[model samples]
Target chain A: MSKYLITIGLETHVQLKTNTKMFCGCSLKFGEEPNTNVCPVCLGYPGALPVMNREAVKLTVMSGLMLGCEISRLSTFDRKNYFYPDMSKDYQISQQARPLCLGGGVTIQTPAGPKRVRINHIHLEEDAAKINHYARFSGVDFNRCGTPLMEIVSEPDLSSPDEALAYVQALKQILVYAGVSDCNLEEGNLRCDVNISVRPEGQEQLGTRAEIKNMNTFKGIYAALEYEIARQLATVARGGVIVQETRRWEPDLGETQSMRSKENAHDYRYFPEPDLVPVALASEQIAAWKALLPELPSARRERMVAEYGIPEYDAGVLADAKENADFFEAAVRLCSPGLGKTVSNWFMTEVMRQLSVTGKTISECPLTPAALAELVELVDKRVINGPTAKELSAELFENGGMPGVLVAKRGLGQVSDSGALEGFVEQAIAANAKSVEDYRAGKKAAAGFLVGQVMKLSKGKADPQRVGILVAEKLARLA
Target chain B: MSHTLDVAYVAELARLELSPDEKRTFQLQLETIVNYVEKIGELDLAGIEPTLHGQALVNVFREDVVVPSLDRECVLANAPERNGFEFKLPKIVEDA
Candidate 1:
C-alpha cells in the first residue's frame, strides 16, 4: 500500500448581517412568511433596477480587512447567467473579474504547529431564494433572495481533515469577531463546500479533485473529507481512475455519492452589471474600516495565554468564541489576578457543560460575570466548599440571581465551626463503628469512609477539609 | 472573426427552447454581430481609457435602510402560478 498526501480546499458562503437586502430595501430577516418580503427589485420584474446597498459593501470590506486581504478600491458586480428556479432572475449579480477582497489567508493551529491556509479571494453576491420540495410540487420562498452573501475561496493548502476543520473554525471566529456575519450553520447563514484530492507521496502533480457540497456543519465537513480521501486513495491504489465530479454528502449514510460530473457544469456567461456603477472606495474610508476591526481570535488567544497564564489549549477554547472570551475576561477582571486560571476552569467545565445541555450561547447565559466572580470569591473565603459552590453554580445557571444571596437564602454556607463539625464527626464515628474498627485494624483508608459519613450527616454543608481533620482527631481518641 | 458562435450552447445556457432552424439562424446572426464588433480593434486608441458605461455617474449607492415591501397579494399577483403565499414550481430534483 502506498501513502498518499491529501489536499483540501474550502469555499464558504456566509450571509452578512444586514438590515436590508443586498440590492433592495426588503428586510433581510429569516423565517418570515414565504414571499412576503418580495418586491419588484428582488423579484426581477421587467424594468426594475437594483441599487447597491452601501452597508453590505462596507461589511465585505470589513471582512477583507479582518482576513488580511487587499481591499479592491474599484470593484463591480457582474451578472452570472444560469437557469435556476432559486433566482427569479435568470442571472445572478456577483463579483467575478474584480472582487471586493483579494489574496488573504487564515492561520490555523494544527497539532504540528501553526499552518497558514491561503485564501484566494472573497467575493460579494446575493443569495438565491430557498426551495422547499414536497411530495409533488416544490415551493420557492423569496424571503432569503437578494441577501448579501460573501463567498470566500481558499487555496488548496490543507493536508489533512483536522487542518481543514481548524481552518473553517478559525475563519468562522474571525467572521464572528468582526461582526460581519452571524455564521450560523443551522440557519443556513453559513455554508461550506470542500474540494479534496489525493496524490501519491512525494508526487509533484496533484490528483483529480472531487468537490463535496452542501455541508452545513464542521463535523459533516470533516467526515465527508475523510470518506472522500479514503475513496480516492483506494481507487488509485487499485489502478482505478478518480473522476472529477461533485458529490453530495449523505450524513446519515456517512458516504458521498456522485451528484454531477464535470461535463454537466454550467457555463455562466459573466458580464458587468449595467444597473449598478463601479464602487470606488477612498483610501481614508478603507483605513477607517480597517481600524474598525476588533481584536481577532488569534491575537486574543495569544494574549489570553500571555496575560492570564492559562494553558494554550484552554486559551484556544476560551478564545474560540468572542462572546465566551469576553465573558471570561470580564469575570477575571472582577477577581484578583491570581484567580485567572480558577476562573477559566469554571467557565471551561461547568459553564460549557450547561451551555451544551441548554443549547444556548454564552451571551445568552443567565449567569453574569460578576455573579460568577462573586461565587468564586465565596469559595475562596470558605463561605462554601468546592461541592457546595458547584451546586450553587447549577442553581445560578438556572435562575439569574446573586450567588451570595442564593447561598444565604438556601443556607448552603459551609459550616467551618469546630464545634459544629466536631459533633458531626463524633456522630459519624458512633454510627460507623465497623469503619472505626477497620481504622484501628491497620486499614488507614478507613478514615476516608468516616469523613464521607460526616459529610452525609452535614448534608454536604460542612467544609470537607475541616471534616477530614475532625474525623482524624475523633478517631485518635479511640486509639 | 475566425471564432464560430455556438448558438445552441448559448440557447441552452439561456434556458431558451429553440428549434433547429432558430439555432441555425441565430448562429449566423451572432457571427455577423461578432464580426462587426471586432472592427473596433482596428482603432489606434492605445492611450484611451475604456469607458465602462455610457453615463458618467459613479458611486451611486443607497443608504442601508428598510423600506416597506409590497403586500403579499400584490407581489404574488404577477406570478404565473402560485400556491397560497409561495410561488409554485415543478418538483426540482436537483439541489443547489
Candidate 2:
C-alpha cells in the first residue's frame, strides 16, 4: 500500500584503478594466474611492514573532492580483527575511527522530481582475497588481496527501488567521470549492499533494518529491494515484527534468506594499525586535489541542455555515461549550426542500436564523430535521401569508412534531376495502368502505389519527394 | 571505571581453540594489563594531543611505481595446503 514508506541506503565498494596493490608493489591486474601478484606485505607474513601507496591516497582524496565531501586532514588506519579465510592475517586494515572523506551526497532524478541522497562517509581500505568454492574443496586467489578499495556509505535517504537505482547510477557516473574507478560491476570492481526498512505512514521512528549484501549488478539490487520491501510490508501488515538481520540475496531464487542474526554479529576490536603511520594532508595538497576535479555529470547535463538547445531528457540520457556524453559533444562540435538536436536523435536511436548489437561502447564505435557528422551533413544537403542515408549508416557502422566515399562507391547518391526522375515516373505509370485508372476514378490513394513502384525501379536511388511530384504531374497529364 | 575482558569471545574472534585453563589465565592477564595501562587516566593534564603512534613521523608514502611481483611458486610455498598453484582449503559452504 502507498500508506507505508520504504527506506533504503547503500554501501558501495569500488576497487580503485591503480597500478599496484594498496600496501605492496604487486600488480593489481585481474585474470592473472592465482597468487602471482602476492607479496610478503600483502600475504601478511610476520615481520613484513606495509608502505601506503601514494596514488591510492591521491585518488581517494580526488574522489572526495568530486563528491563534495570534507577531506579529513588527519586520517589513520585501524585493524578490524576477524577470522576469515579471505585475509591471511585474520584482520582487516580499515578506517574505523576516522575515514578519509565525510558527508557528501548524490542527486538522483525520480519521476516525482530530483532528490538528493546524503552519503555518510567514504573510507579507503584494502580488499580481501577471492575464494572459489567447488563440490569438495575451495581455492583462494590472492591476486585481489590488498587491492585498494573505497567504501561509500550513504545515509538512508532513498525511498523506492527506482530511487536506489538512480542513486547508484549517478554515483557510478560521477566516479567514472572523475577517473576514480572504472565502476565495472562484472569483474567485481563495484559491489553494493542495500539496507532497507519500512515503516507505516506518518511514523517518525524507523523500523528494523535488514541488509542485503553481495549484489554485483544494478538489476539485482533493484529486484532485491523490491522483493525485500514487499516482504517487509507484508510482515507488518500481518502484525508481525521485522527482525534486524543480514540477508543474502539469492538472485536465482529471487528471494532473500537470513544469513546472520544480531546476536552473531562480530564485535570487531578496532584499534589503530601500528605498522602504518598517520596521514596528515596539508591545505595546499587538499586544494590541489580539489582543483583537479572535473565538471561532474549533473552539471554537464544541465550545460548540454542549455548550450546545445537539446531537450532536458535527451541531455540526461547522453550525460548518464561519461563516454556517451563525450562522444555527443565531439560529434556536435563537427555538426553544422543548429543541428544539435539532429545529432542527439541519431545518437539516441541509430547509434545506440548499433552499440547494443555489436556489444561495444560509444568510444569503441568504428564510426568516428567526423564520419557521423559528414553523414548528417549529406542528408541535410540532400546529397543523399533519408533512406540512402539510413542504409549508409548501417554500412558505416559495420565497416569504418568515410560516408561520402561509401556513397560514391555504392552509387547511392539521390537522383533529383528532373529528366532522370521523369523517365522513371513515366515507366512506373506505364507499368501500373490499373493504378492510374483507379486514381482517375477518384481512388486518390492509388498514386502512393505508383510512387512506391518508381522507387523500386530506381533501386531506392531516386529522391522520394521529387518522385512524388513527378508522379503527380505524369498522372494529371494522362488524365 | 573498570573494564572486563571476555577471553572466550576474544579467542573465538581470533579463531583460536583455547583450553579452559588458558582462557581463564588470559582473562586475568588482560585485566591486569588494562589496569596497569589505566594509570595514565589519573593525570589531570588537559589540551594534550593524543599521539597516534610511538614515532613522530607522518606522510610516509611510496610513489606509484610498478615493481616485480614474487614468483608464483615462491608465493604459494608458504601455504599450509596447495592445489595446482593455489591455496587449497576445506570446502567453504558459504556463498559469495
Candidate 3:
C-alpha cells in the first residue's frame, strides 16, 4: 500500500549453555560474583593460549543439524580486530571465512502460509565481558568473557515486522527445544541485531541500510523495526538519501538514534587465528551428531496434532515451551489411550489457568501427571460431578494428592444410583408442593429450582444431569 | 611483484599513529620481508591444500569442565584502577 518496499535481516547471537567457557576452563555461570571466573586465557594475557572446548563445538554442530544447515567439513577461527574495554582482548576469535554451518533456513508461519527465512551462516564465537556505565567512569566485569556464543546471520528474506517476530520466535523455539541454549532474553542469553532498508516500489537495487545493534527482547526488535522503517521512508519522501550506518534502539524513547556514522565504521581485518588450530570435522562425526539430535519443536508440533487428534491451536500452545509439551505428553500417556483431547481440554482450561494464577511454570507444577490422569478417569466414569471435580482441581494444583484417595477421604464422589436419585426426588417433591403444582400448571422452568433443592439436600454430591432427568420423570408422573 | 602495500591504511587498521619518517623506513623494511616471503610462489604447489599452521593438527580440543579460576583479588591486582570489585576505566562516549 505504500510507495516503498522494506527488507529486514537479523543477526542473532545466542549464548550456549555450556559448563565452561569457550577457550578456557572458567565456569560459565550467570549472576555470579564479578571477576570470579577470570583466567589467563580469557583475560587475554600476554602469553595465554586458548584451547577450544569440545562441547561448544558439538552443540554448535547439533544446532546446525537441527536447522538443516550444511555442516562445514573444515571450519577455522579468525581474529576480528577491534579495540574495546568489554573484550580486554584486542581481537575476538570468531569465524569469518569458514564457519560451522552454511545455507539453512527457518520456516516461519505467516498469514498467507509458511515462509522460509534463509540463513547466511552460523558461526561460533566468544562473548565479551559485561560493562556497566557510570556517571564518571565505567566498570567492567570479566565473568562473562570467553563464553561460547553462536551468531546466526539471516539473509534479507523478511519483508515485514510481523514476519520478523515470527521468524525470531520460531528460531528461539527450535534452539530451546534443541537444548543448545536457554534462549532467555531477560538473562541476555539471546541478543539480536537488525539490519533494515527501504527502497522504492519496483526498484531492483536495494537501498542503503541502517543497522540496529544489541536488542535483547522480541518486543524491542519489533518496535525498533517499526520506528526505523518509518524513519527511512520519511527521509526518502523528502528527497533525502539513506545513509548506511550503525544505530541503537532506544526502547525508552521509542526510536532509533544514530550511534556512529559510516566514516567511523569498523574495518575488521580478519585473519586466521594462530593460537587455535583449524577444526577439521570428519564426515562420520557429523553423521553421529545428526543422529544424536532430538526431535525439534516444529516436528513435535505436527506429531502432537496428528497423533493426539487435538486442534492445531492446542498443539501450538502446548509446544510453545518444551517443558509444557513434555508435561502434556506425560499426562496423556498415563491417561486412557484415546483421551488425549480430554487431557488437552483440562490443560487448556483448568491446568493453564491454575498455573497462571499461581505464577508457576509447568515444570514447577506440584500436581503430578498421574494424579491428573486419575482425575480425568474419575470424571469419565461418572464418579465425580463437574462442580466437585473443579473444586478438587484447585486443591490438587495447590497441594498434590491422589484424586481417588482424595475423593474417598472427603466423600466428594457423585451419587448416581437410581434408587438414591428417586429418594432425593421424592423428598424434593414432597417438600416443594408449590413448585410441583406450578409444574403441573405448565410452569416447566420451576423444575430447575427443584433440581437445585435436590443438589443442596444431597450436599452437592448428586449428579445434576441424572437428577434433572429424574425430576422431569417425577413431575410427569404426578401430572 | 604487483603487490602494493598501503602503509598508512594498514597503520590505521592497527590503530597505530606512525610518524612520516617511521612510515617511510618501515615501508622498505616490510617490502623486503614480503619479497623474501614471496619466493614460495614460484614452487609448483598446485596439489597441496592451504595450510594454516606449522604442525599437522586438527580438532584439538579440551573437555568441557570447570577448573578453578584465579582468585578475584589476584585477578584485579594488576588493574590500573578498580571500583570495589570491578575494573574501572574512563567514561566511554561510544557504545561497544
Candidate 4:
C-alpha cells in the first residue's frame, strides 16, 4: 500500500415505498408510461400546494430508529433552489439544517473486528424527474418527481473501500429488516455518492477531496473509489495538488471523470418550504415508533446462533433475508426439540438447492414451513429412511403436501418391524445363495450385497439397517 | 450607502438578462427591501427562536392514499414541445 491514508464518506439516497408521492397523491410506480403519473403538485403547476405524506415521515423515522439514530423532535422542510430540468419547480424540497434523524452509526465487521461507521444525519427529500437523453432532444418524465427519498449521510470514517462496502451492506440490511425501503440498486431505489480524500500517512489536515456521484452498484462504487484514490495518490506524488471537484463514474471506461469544479457548483439557497408545515413529533409518538422497530439483522443472527444452536455461517445465511429466517424459525418451532441443526441442514442443502432451481424465495414456496417440519420429523422418528425421505422431499417441494399423509397415501413408510422384514431377508438369502456362501466362507462384505438384495426385493421399503440385522441372524443360524 | 449585493449575479441565478440601467434600478430597490428587513435585528430577541414559517401550525400531514392522476393528455397540454407522451426540451449534452 502507498504511504497515504484515504478517508471516505457516503451520501446514500433511498426511495421509500409509499403509496403516493412525497407531497402529492400521484402513485409512485416505475416502468409506467411516461408522464402518466403527473399531477398539479408533482408537475409544479402554479398555485398548487404540496401536502406532506405521513407515511413517508413514519418510514424515515423507522429507518432512523433501526440505525440507532436520535429522532428529532421538530423537523421542517426546505427548498433547495436550483435551475435543473430534473425538477420542474426550479427548487427541490429537502431538509437542510434540521433533519429527521441524527447521530446514528452502522457497525460493520472488519478484519480487526466490528467497527462502527458514524452517520452524520438522515434527511427526507423529494426525488427529481427522469431525464432521458436522446440524440436530438431530451425527454422529461415527471412520473418519478416528488417521490419520497431519504439521504443518509455518513461521516468520513471509512479507511478502505472494503470498509465502505461493509458499511453500506450493513446499512441496507438494517433498512431491509425494518421494511423501510427495497434497497434495490437496479431499480434506482437506492443510490450513493462517495466523498473521498487522501493525505500522507501522518498528516494532520485532510487533502482536497473529490466526490463521485450517482454510483448505483457495489462493484461500481468499489472500482470508482480504487481508481479515484490511485489518481489522487499519483497527483500528490507528482508534486501536483488534488482539486476539489465533482466527478462521474464511467463504468464502461472503468474510471471517474471530472464533472465540475467547486467554483462551478450551484449555491443552493435554502429556505423553509412555505407550503408544508413543520413536523413536531411528540415524545410519545417517537416512543411508539421505536417500539415498532423490528429486530435488526445482526441481533437476529446472534439470537439464531444462540437459540437454534446453529453455526455462525449458517446463522448468517438464514438471517440475510428476513423471510428465510422467519421460515427457519417457523419450521423449527413446529419440529421436535434439538432438531434446529437438522432443519438448517435441510435448508442449506436441499431447500436452498430447490429454491435456486425453481427461482423462488421461501415466501413463494408451496412447501410451507409446517410441511418441512413434518418431513424432518418423519426422518427423525424413523418413519421414513434417508433416501425415502429425500425422494419424498423432492415431491413435496414440487407439489406441497404433508409428508406423513403422502407417505401413508403412497404406502412409502419404512419396514422396520423384524417380523415384517424377516420374509424379505429370507428371500434375499435364498435368491443370493452365492453371496450367502461367500458370507459363510468369511466374506464379510457379502452381507452388504445381501442387504441390497433385500432392499430390492422389498421395493426399497425395508430399512437397510433393519435388513442388515435380520440377514446376520438368518446367516448365522444357517451356519 | 453603496449596495454590497451583486444584482447581476442574482439576475444570472434567476435566468434573467438585465441591462445596466435595469440592474441599477433593481439594486436600489433591493437595498430598500433589505434595509427594511434588517430593522428586525434591532429588537431584543436573543432568546427567541427563528420562525420556520409564517403559520403557527405543525405536524400537518396528509394520508398516504393515492388518488387518480391527471389525464396524460391534459398533463402534457401545457408543454411547449411534446415527444409523444413526454415533454421535450432542447438537446442537453452532459458535461464530460
TM-score of each: 0.88, 0.90, 0.96, 0.94
* Candidate 3 structure quality by residue, lDDT tens digits, B1-96: 447877887887777999999999889899888888889898988999888776778998999999999999999999999988999999976652
Please write out the lDDT profile of model 3 over residues A237-348, one tens digit for every residue.
9889888888999889998889854343477889899988889899999998888887888788899999999999999889888888888888898887889999899887
* Distance from true location, Cα of A163 in model 1, Å: 3.3
Name the candidate, 2 or 4, with the larger DockQ value: 4
Q: What is the lDDT of residue A413 in candidate 1?
A: 94
lDDT of 2 by residue, A263-351 (tens): 43457889999999999999999998888888998899899999899999999899978888888899899988888999999889998
What are the runs in model 2 whose C-alpha is more than 4 Å off?
A1-5, A199-203, A230-241, A260-265, A473-479, B5-12, B15-36, B43-45
Positional deviation of residue A184's Cα in model 2 after best superposition, in angstroms: 2.1
Better of 2 and 3 by lDDT: 3
RMSD of each: 3.3, 3.0, 1.9, 2.4
Off by over 4 Å in 4: A260-262, A429-450, A471-479, B1-4
User: After TM-score superposition, what is the CA distance of residue A314 in candidate 2 from its true location, in Å?
Assistant: 2.1
lDDT tens digits, residue span A44-78, model 4: 88899999999999999999999889999999899
**If both were scored by TM-score, which would come out higher, candidate 1 or candidate 2?**
2
Among these predictions, the greatest TM-score belongs to: 3
Give residue B59's lDDT in candidate 1 (0 to 100).
81
lDDT of 1 by residue, A1-479 (tens): 87888999999999999999999999987878898888888988888999999999999999999988999888878999877798877889999988999999999888888888999999999998888888989888899999999999999999999999998888888999999999988898889999899998989998899889978899999899889988998899889999888889999999999984434355688998999898888999999888888998878999999898899999989988899999999999898768889999999999999999999997787899999999889998889999988988988888878899988888999999999998999888888899999999999999999988889999999999999988888789898
TM-score of 4: 0.94
Ranking by lDDT: 3, 4, 1, 2
Alpha-carbon lDDT, every model = 0.89, 0.89, 0.90, 0.90
